[model samples]
Target: MTEQAAAVVDETTVAADLVTQLEYDRYTHEDPVPDWRPAKPFAAMVGALLLQELEDASDGWLHRTLDADPELAANLGFEPDNPPSRSAISRAWSGRLAELCSTIETSARQIRQLAAERGSPIGGPYETNASEEPTGSSKRTVNRLLRRKARDLLDELQTVVLPAFELDRPDDLVYDDEELLTLEACLGVTGTAANGGAETYGDFVNPDPALDDPFYEDGPSGETPLEAIKDLSPTDIAKMVNQGAARVLTRAKPRLEFETPVMLSIDITYVAFYGEREELVRVQGAPEDKSYDWCYKFATANVVGDNVHFAAGMLPVGHADYHDSDAYPGKDKSYRVGDVVRRLVDHVNDVCRIRIRRLYADREFYATDVFSTLEQREIFYVIPARRDDRVKRFIARMNEDVDGNKQVTVKHDNAVYGPVKHGGTKSSTETTLVSLPPDEDRKEPQVFATNLDVNDEIGLDRRWAKKQINRYSRRGGIETAYSKIKEFAPWTTSTNFSIRLFHFGFAVLLYDLWLLVDFLVQTLIDVVEVRTKPRVTAPRFRAFLRREVSALL
Candidate 1:
């Protein structure tokens, strides 16, 4: 037989075998299968391939490559007569994209754990064994399966793949016992407390030693009851305080108990981006007053306590002069800050059956309605009074009496005094200026207003009034929590889409969870890596990758 004729016969036989295999695969599956079930897995395989190369090639190029490669086309279950439509590929993504994200989050968590255990010089000392472990099994499984697929194809694409395309193993693959405990702490489930037991007592734990030292502390010269512990991990600090508070309440077993108050800080910031300089008219008649302009406003709020939270709620802007302006209706829409605050308050109240003694807010919460509502609920509140003419006059009067000394302290009863000014065009009301006592450096009098009247000479003492000021001053703690939310969570960024709101919320929750993990890791590090002082930065990512790789291995 001629060589050409023999080759043709062999090719025919190979083609026949391929056809037989295809038919068997399609027919053997009895599921209410898509007409393409046997071939469907092939589509998933190709989709994964596209994802791997997505960064480099255009979509068209990828499609063409798939078309040209015979083995790939067959593996994708593409028949000679029928090819997968672009829409089909696109549609498939919707079904699997979530799985991909879940995979990534899981991988990140696992890798962090592994890195903490092996790479960290810090020995594992912390651990958390909960009755119910946080559930992420489905996500982890999906990530593991996809990662395995990637590994199997590694050798085939080694030469073509760029170095950047290679995934790096996370540094936090292994977590010591301490790291595990930290994770628990961040999750708000670190230590177990006996419910209403004899051992439990209600007392705030003074974790920070600095709180005892007056000089080092930021506030007044007395030892503040709240201890300021430095160098402790945020997660650990939060957990320890919460757990201690919980235990204390359990022991007290009081008829009325109060849940620990979670503080959320809200702030507004504006950022402006300009491509080039733009001129603005200063006045219609004065050309000399013209100036160039570039500016915009971006307002955001950070709600932090055990977990970081955020909202894109509206903030009202109103002008006293323009009460009828059309812009006021839309631009000055009411925000839901009060609603959120109420919900938080309710949560605590329901859990502990104890009323929140007071909500501390800065001048922003000085709105009469807000104060009135809290008062109606029998909730005490300490909010800074807006510094209007009344406050200024009181300060001026005190200064005059003291021979130019700015400090003075006094008490007054009932009648509102000071300047009458309209704030936000709402109403014309008088602001009462009550003087507080002189502090160390300045004898100048500080002024404030409150509805509560102090008739008793001792009750009106400046020291008592100053205490109110100090208590409200602690509201700044909310700002610190806000900073952490923006710094650590990606969702807080303005660019995040609303579709991902729930996911972002979940991510923040996970971050809180990671903080607990970090506390445990830090504890372990203290024990194991203390001398070497090894540090792990991206513990979550590290734990995730390590877990996936371990599974594959």
Candidate 2:
């Protein structure tokens, strides 16, 4: 046997001897205990083999060493006709696969010390612009194999292994706080520090607004370097513009108007996954038409009040009604939009504890019935009225009065109006717009309508108008989330519906997991950094604790 294998065997022998001595000592002290016994010889031998497998230079080292040793070979009952090959030893190891898996898992958990020292990869694959290929040679295969094995092991634990460990009480099987924490550590976040890392969202925030301003000039010769860079190609400019817009939309923003009651902001995104050719067929009313120009819609709602928070509700367009010719009439068929908005408002009232007074949306949600429904439910709403002839005339008159440079505040008479042009067809509408003061430089306009009395003092300020516009614009963030999912997560832009659903679910789960990891890492950092001593020495402190416990034992 190699020296390492011998040492492992010796360590097991010493542990068994120590256990025997401890049991004897306890017996001498009249402690009530069962008779002590050494581990089975075969078990000890198997453990030694496992240790050698981990420590040896290659896969077949222990098997080769065993084959050459006559005594060891004889002990294992190997004959001339059926000598144990390396493959046989490998099969033997496979027989204790669960034990091996457990050992590897334990070793992986212990390697957190090394991982902490090395640090994790900041940002996900999408965020970091990483290549699609797996990082290392074995990484892909090993992760796949490990995940498959882990699922099987979890099933076995739930169905067989856990039940076998019967106890006096059933409650013992329940996961305790520490066990749950360990599980969170294992399955929660896989990589990198959450915050304070190079690629964290906070890192993107420029402290000085002047540095971020596009118009800012330093010792100007009538232009900054940014202006000088306009000489670049159109393709480059387009790429930069697209990327810049994505960055601006995705970056987190601060909450405004804390005293305002929470309201739902619902918006619909129509994605044409299939080309327009197939979509035209579905629109032409062929039920059995297997074409693909279908429109898929997702509606997301965010609650706006003291703090902006995500509301857990989504509305998906039904395939049947979405493409039905009779329901959606002409080219301006946008009934699905109204349905999604109503669902979001209903969800907010049902799920959120606070009283929601108003619902907010852009001109897309300008249905007369929508306003009526809210009024019937005793809810107020501030939706931008669609620009029809009447609204255009009103805006023109107001523009003349306020001279386009200043905001024109006006109130609409509470009178029901007639059919107005929407999408394409005309629909009967009844709503009035009361314009709040608008900031010309900010380009934010506010309009409100409800059956309830308007608080003119709070409503007339340009700041309020700006805040409303900002709140309404925040709904666009969901588009960024969708883009991130399509780019980073397992999701694809493919037309296969089943695969698409799978990918979407995976993306959402991934986002949730990322949030969970961020929370854990932030909590740990806060505890360590804000403590009495330097938090940077936490790993050293942990090592010290382990050593102290080992010495005590």
Candidate 3:
């Protein structure tokens, strides 16, 4: 080799000492590296990828950097004398699909075991010939598999899937461990807890050290994390994540404890963008602001029925196609909302094989398209009606029939409702508008529309429409899920939609995990006579997870 090339190779000698993430990626169905070819130090390759991530370098630039940059090569454990070729490094990344998948499964199983231990301690660690074998959770336990699904889906993104798309794995990523620890971090913040347990425990001996995090204090102090993460979001990663998460949830269906239909609550959370990247769409948040943020909106699909309250998927919103509603209800275009609901429902229904019992959305979602979609799907829904003259007339007529000094209620059985036409491209349909008398909290009477017939729907017992209207109030769980998810998310201000997407996705995953633990912990405590047992709080849970994560690094 020429002296110049030799000089370039000399700079990466540091790979000789450090260990790389390749080990975490390795699990034996027997080893694949043949002895005839000497093993190259992979740690340097790890360093190269890290540098590439932080710097968003082209492959050509990364090749040159690895050959010549001593600091970068050394940190990744490279031997400066023999750094890998660009082609060789590329091959290493592209061929790892099987290994990456294996790692995710392995990690997912570990999380399932940890969850089994909490509230339902199966036997401790199982030994080949020992007298005691680790026990599994009781067969009767509820939502156990769902808990596992949440962890598997959450961790797969950072560790297995994201790395494939980014050509690098998450630095310092933690997989589905600390079932109890996570319970403390996520549930501790929400202040929801149970008072008892199942008298079981899960324990492991000499657990592997957690993978190191290179983005935070755990990484080299000299590096800036934001600059390194630019290429992490490949074009199709978002769609993959959406499909993968649904797949995970779908797989858990056979293990479901009951046959009840699923209830989903969908809401769009508007996140403001502070960047000038031109794709930004205009979104108005809150009524008082003069100007809205150039923002990207995300739709959160959550399970809110049969007492389940975990988040499932978050779909990103694009430039919405809007048109004026018939007679101008002044509502935001309903077609976008309908389109999101239809797509999400079809996706989840295909995966989970469960019918939707009902859908609960906030008042802002009252677009003409939304109502038509719900009715067409035969999915019952309750959304605030546009408080137009027709709705007020319904309230006024109901009020006039009331006895003096007593407030009027929905006692009308054979009643008629004002019809409103709405939709775009798809033909318009009429929705029944029902007005609710105001309570102490909301002085203005609430007007809502629904397709539920009093005699036709199950559990529609109350002749007065209060019973149907009351179901919407039960949707508060999803609203609470949003607030707590934002609390659990790590702070980021990247203008890249992918980065923003990942941030939001990770937060949703964390929130779902906490809910699972919270549900198990709650059920364990809320039942029977053991209600005094201490419930883990959210703050304490956060601190517990933080300290545990730091220790892993």
Candidate 4:
């Protein structure tokens, strides 16, 4: 028992130190100490609250348990004769949450300082940069150029994008435009600080951004960079910030504005929660770590136009498991693929100001209600047909209708009023189904529900089925977007849903910025009509910004 207690003590060195150092008066100045009786230390109250947390016990139960169990009371810093009331513990817990957070923060800071002092490079344990020389310039010039470009990017993002999005900034927000841009860029560059990019960034920024450093020859976040960016007219400037993610999402598909007949791809991406299951709002799907199993889901909408892929809207999903609610089937089955589809589609159309030409989804999102919902919105959709009995019957009927030894190139289109319903789905009125039979050319039967009228009046012809199928294939871009996005994440094991959400939101923003940067840089290259090209790719730009952001951290 003594050996076990010692092991526990060793494991809880930081927590024990925290408890030992904390002053009683610091947490409870409002509750005055009586002169007649001496007050107990705040650690005892904290210990009591912790005991409640560990056991997840109710107030009355915890009060009884503590009084009855002498061992538990002693372990929790409570005397058997003079046990603290549950009310006193609750008040203390409520009063000192911020202080507790600060204590944790201080411990974290000390750990980071220790690592830094030990001369362990913050770029993490791995080498981030691929061995390559700077493009079209000396290493010194490239570093200097990166600093200038970063400041320019931030200035543009702040003055233009923030105003355009009409996003309200919290008054107490510590990270200003410059800082957020740096952070955002790092989020893009390192993918996430937890991913080692922040450490890499910190290494560079601390040394380079100073006046003495060769990179900041013209000082930091000042005039030279701004002056260089001024020649870009309102149209050019508009082009610059439009692609940057405004308020975590843009007002419209700026990159896809002129490029018409766009295909919007809807897909689910998962960010795995390492925390306790009860603490998270999770869903079932492949979350990288557990791709084959159920995990937290994020439904994202991506659009491809003129060779540029734009990540449009992202919605976090909530899931319902059947085992938990057999008694109440009505309550457990609210979150559906159709629900996310509607949300992301509405977001893109209404919030993003992009008129959807067609929406493409994968096989997992296959449901008659999803098709019905799209039809109701007058949105065209292409999804891999779920080979259900009803859909199989439809395909079998089409296969039988084919005449002679001729290939089954025949296309069938029908309006589904209420074909199959599930999850309390209402009736469908104008939903159209386009089905293609399996043949030697196309091995499997293809099915899609779309609002695209097949009448000859609107250039809809026999080839429309093949054309739409090819268009739906473009949804593959969202998969690549997902891969790129996951790279930018700051790895964490935090139980706070908000922290996880922020990390994801920031990563999305960074990925968008990367796409925009590549497009914009290439555009400028074309404008210059020179062999000289963009030296910094997304990864390299991130490497540069990662150093900048990490330094700030």
Best by lDDT: 4
Each candidate structure's TM-score, on Cα atoms with residue i matched to residue i, is 0.35, 0.39, 0.54, 0.54
Please write out the lDDT profile of model 2 over residues 91-178, one tens digit for every residue.
5456533344454334323322122112211111111111122333243543343333233222222222122111122344332322
lDDT of 4 at 538: 57
> Where in model 4 is the C-alpha error above 4 Å?
1-151, 157-188, 192-204, 208-257, 273-292, 319-329, 397-426, 436-443, 455-461, 527-537, 547-553
Quick one: ranking by lDDT, best first?
4, 3, 2, 1
- What does candidate 1's lDDT look like per residue over 1-553, in tens digits? 1122122322112211222132223222332336645544543333333332321233344455555655656654566335455555555445534344353234323322332212221111122111122333344543443343333222111211111011122355332322222222222211121121101111111224364554332211111100111223322332232222222222122111122443333343222223332331111121232242332221222222222122212121111221223322224433323333443355334532334555555454455444444545666555455667755655556522336544334445313322111223242223234565466743644555554432224544444655655544443534443333333322211221221121122223333333333333333222221111112223433344233321221
lDDT (Cα atoms) of all candidates against the true structure:
0.32, 0.36, 0.47, 0.50
| Local accuracy of candidate 3 as per-residue lDDT tens digits, 175-212 | 22232223222222333221111001111111342446
Ten contiguous residues minimizing lDDT sum, candidate 2? 121-130
Candidate 1: list runs displaced more than 4 Å: 1-332, 336-344, 347-354, 399-460, 491-511, 514-553
Q: Which ten contiguous residues of candidate 3 have the minimum total lDDT?
A: 194-203
Residue 422 C-alpha lDDT in model 1 = 22
Q: Cα miss at 197, model 3 (Å)? A: 35
Write down the TM-score for model 1: 0.35
Ranking 2 against 4 by TM-score, winner: 4
